[model samples]
Target: MEGGGGEQALSADNVRGIVLALISSGFIGGSFIIKKKGLRRAAAASGIGAGVGGHSYLLEPLWWVGMITMIVGEIANFVAYAFAPAVLVTPLGALSIIVSAVLAHFILKERLQALGVLGCVMCITGSMVIVIHAPQEQEIASVKEIWKLATQPSFLLYVALVIVMVSVLMFHFSPLWGQSNVLIYTAICSLMGSLSVMSVKALGTSLKLTFEGTNQLVYPETWFFVLVVSTCVLTQMNYLNKALDTFNTAIVSPIYYVMFTTLTILASIIMFKDWSGQSLGSITSEICGLIVVLSGTILLHVTKDYERIPQSKSIYAPLSPSLTTRLTGELLDHVEDGRASDEEKVLRRQEMF
Candidate 1:
């Protein structure tokens, strides 16, 4: 399955990547639920939640088990990067969100509201749009070229802004609002994720070039990127785990997806100019897709419960326009009768009942 224009043909590597992504999603999803359960148990024993002033989860064996599971997923994800395009692998993380949502419903008794489901759909749709139209990884002539990209004024400025944002989030916002707001922690993780992606891309390119016998391992810049990637990833994982402990697992996944994907793509565009080679139509589609994704995140945040079956016979009718229309059809048989065929009228009457 070759992609149109600049896309990699689906190869064995791509297939292997997709499979690993699926496995990673399953493990990561289960890990989140298990860890949250551990956190809850710890918080209960400690007489406070982590968001407030609890730390007993630090010694919880279950939490450590979940952490080990997550590490396995991360290792799989690391290998995935070597196999597939980032665009392909990153958006596929939606599988983890779905897994988390379903597990939360069963294990945590947390419901997935209709709006949240819609949000997940929109997020997945937008991510696919971005992935499909995304720019292919540029061929790296050398690790030095990557260093040059990192040192570019625009990217340097972006890095500086990320540092400032993370600082404000940690030192300024976290102290005052950390207990109540999941954003403080999630924001830190997402900001670092953007930087980590850049470093990972550089390191990935280095490895690829090295595999090709270019021998990039000799370059100090390659090792520098590796160090940057490791630091950023660890920081992200720590904050992400904290976020999982503090908020509803259902909420965390979509919000994290929206934040992480949006920032990573933004950083990639800024640093790599991935859009530079794309046509205006493609760029417009990608932007529109991202907007759709943002809309979904908003929907997730504003989640309302789905309509449930009424337990009583009173049948409390909703005030939605569709409900109103359904009710109106019951009384307007005379008006609508002649306009419909016998079959249509039968179905209409059936719906009214």
Candidate 2:
């Protein structure tokens, strides 16, 4: 009876997590539009932009509102992780891409071409597949256990690799190409994001256990997780702001989602081994889903580049009768003024020229 009851409770927890994730997606999606508007306002007023490393958006009230919204959404997401597996929680973030793209189309006056729409559908489909096959969260009892998993050689190696690459990207490539290329900013955010998520999950677990009376707060390891989450979140926010200010939101959201989601999943798989004990077919399906995601990402970038190619104007376009008549009248007026006084003629010549 106790075992049955525990299973039932786990099911309920999963449902609750899903609801929280959906709500978080909506808030995060809307926050993108609001913050983007704030960035635009700041740039227009201060003649500087976040893309150029400007901090003027810090002064914009609307930006603060967006930041608050994001914080609320992130809090919800943080809790969702406590209730469910990272694989389940992370893929659901594809929903935010839909929200951001739709809002950008209507509010920001950004056009999402047909291919871009198709790409979004593919991304969502892939994410849903991954979610459906996602394994349940591994049971964690204490912050010490999480700290142990984190200190494993494999996970530590992943952390080291992330730190080294981020340093190179930050110190070398960003100054030379960040403004022109969207990937540089997005990459930095995504890389930090993988580590941040692990830390967030650790902290969330710590808080959850504390609430349940285990009192995880006493451990210094819990505080270490807290510090990591804080640094990573701040870093993500900084580069994400730059990406938004520099590129189209329609473009930034999905690319960031793909990169972030992919890296997070990799990190989770490495740390949590979320796929362990899964059926072969289930694992195959997840791989297929990732392929679909990559295809969608490529399609989106190609479509965006295609849209940028200027259309050739037709030389044989017909003029309206009114326009033709107006041109003829103007020509006749100029023709009729055949001669003038020397001074006036010279002035007229200057004006015409």
Candidate 3:
């Protein structure tokens, strides 16, 4: 009877994980679209010149809007993690690629060739497979257990830090016109976002602005982890934005979410030891799922033709004022021919000049 009950519990867990994964993926897809729109609106409101500096009072409203949107997205994601297994939820988040592609086609008027659509479908299928088959009831370790795992010497963290620093430096030196500014801005925004998340976690549900104790700011390990994660996320976002400038969202968004989702799964496993008691069969299924997701992403890559859309032509040709003025002078000359005095001709010449 107990064995049957355990089996039933396991099945329930699997169902919950799969559902959460789908929900999380939808949220992630919505987030990319929202972020793109928010950034565009912010840029429009503040004007182009606002990009010249790191800090802009004029951009405050836009930042707040973006921050709020991000916060909402994060909360939704947190809920997903709370209810679903991380392995399931993380892969499901890869659905952002499909979401982004569809949104880009309709909203941005971007073209999605046959290959692009294929890629999107592949990514979706692959990710779904991975999440669906992942182990349903891995052991849930406490914060302390997770922290111990994270504290282990990791060259990856240091490597990530160095890369981030170099990226920041490159951003500083790069000219403004090349869209390098977008990278820096993205990094800053990401950092701000990470801080916002940390604040929410630390402050609990109320999210009160009141600072009741100074000691709350003293968790170095927490801050370090936050910084690393924030920088990585921001860098990814910046790259994704830059890619969008070249590739349509359809091509770029899916690849990104797939990459991030894969990385996050690995990170979760390594940092939290979350898969401590999973069976070999469950692990194999999870791996196969990831492989399927990757296959889909590859299909998307093949479908993209790397062709830029042609610019739309204006319906009416614009009149040049200088050309109009010159034409008017010529007409006046024709009218005054042979009938006008020498003084009149001289005056007309001066006016034309």
Candidate 4:
């Protein structure tokens, strides 16, 4: 019994899944640097930047190469989901953020602050906690079961909230706060990212079962998940591109990770009931893991602290006659009062004169 349990704990499929996820994250992280370079090249060649609604990057071969590499990473991620629970897979994406940061430091010549390194360490610690306490994936028989979960009132309410938040950010806030606030764009992308994550899991399940001869493709439920996944991913990619162009990756990467991971975990809890059968200790550990991850994200964002320091307005203020009025007045008064010394000084200075 002990040997069997041990074997179950470290199944080959889960091991394969972990390896695939690692590879996927490496590629995805590097893709950000490549794509950004492509965008810069495109913008230099043209007048408009990608951030302000330009698509010249699409014409750049480098951009296409980045897209291809990113797609390959995404494919690996999708396959990993079939073999491992999302709780195991999603947090691992933080590895991509670290990759992006390191790459940005070397390639983009961005400085990695001391706090930023600490943040990466916190991220790793949190991921370990989360992985250790993560609840097991449920046995899924059909795509229809996942559809039922999606349509449930609890999950429906969650979806409704996400839609409302995303809508407010896009339609209401994006017009006014979009340019100044990085959150506006990153929040939108993260919200859509959460939805995309859920859909990806559903679709991945269907494909996995189909590959095993169950033929899940015949179900309309599978098709619906595919469509939702496609829409959400496209929407996320569009806004994410804008955010990456406008904001520093150090800032955007962490904030995006915090929101996306938090929301995805929430969605999973609601839809899959991942915590239903878990002990209180496990649940508490999961929450702690989340906190640790958030702390790391905050620390990473601290690297942008230098940008937040207020610039002095005096730099632009021109010199004025009145600017030194008080000092000049005091000096003038002293000189005037000492003028009597001129008579006494005349006697002393007569020899010199």
Query: Against the unseen true structure, what C-alpha lDDT does each candidate score?
Result: 0.63, 0.66, 0.42, 0.65
Tell me how far the alpha carbon of residue 150 in candidate 4 is from the true structure, in angstroms, after superposition. Answer: 1.4
The 10-residue segment of model 3 with minimum total lDDT is: 322-331
Off by over 4 Å in 2: 1-12, 31-69, 103-113, 172-185, 238-255, 293-353
- Better candidate by lDDT, 1 or 2: 2
Model 2 scores worst on lDDT over the 10 consecutive residues at 323-332
Cα RMSD to the true fold for all candidates: 15.9, 16.2, 17.1, 18.7
Clashing residue pairs found in predicted model 1: none
- Candidate 3: count the clashes: 6
Q: Which pairs, if any, clash in model 2? A: none
Give the top-scoring candidate (TM-score). Answer: 4
Off by over 4 Å in 3: 1-21, 31-71, 82-86, 104-111, 136-142, 152-224, 227-262, 301-306, 309-353
- Per-residue lDDT over 40-145 for candidate 4, one digit per residue giving the tens place of the 0 to 100 score: 6776777654433456768999868876876677678778776666666777766666676778789867678998899889878986777666666677889998
Q: Extract clashing residue pairs from model 4.
A: none
- TM-score winner between candidates 3 and 4: 4
Output the TM-score of candidate 2. 0.66
Better of 1 and 3 by TM-score: 1
Better of 1 and 3 by lDDT: 1
Q: What value of lDDT does candidate 2 attain over all alpha carbons?
A: 0.66
What are the per-residue Cα lDDT tens digits for candidate 2 across 1-353? Answer: 11111221235556667778778777777776777777667767777555334567789999789868766776777788887767677776556656766787798776778987997888788766765666667778999999999999999999999999999989999999998899998899889888888888888888989999999999999999888977886777678667655665446555776788778888989998877777777777777777675666555555543232122111111111101000000000111133433222221111100
Q: In model 3, state the lDDT of residue 47.
A: 50
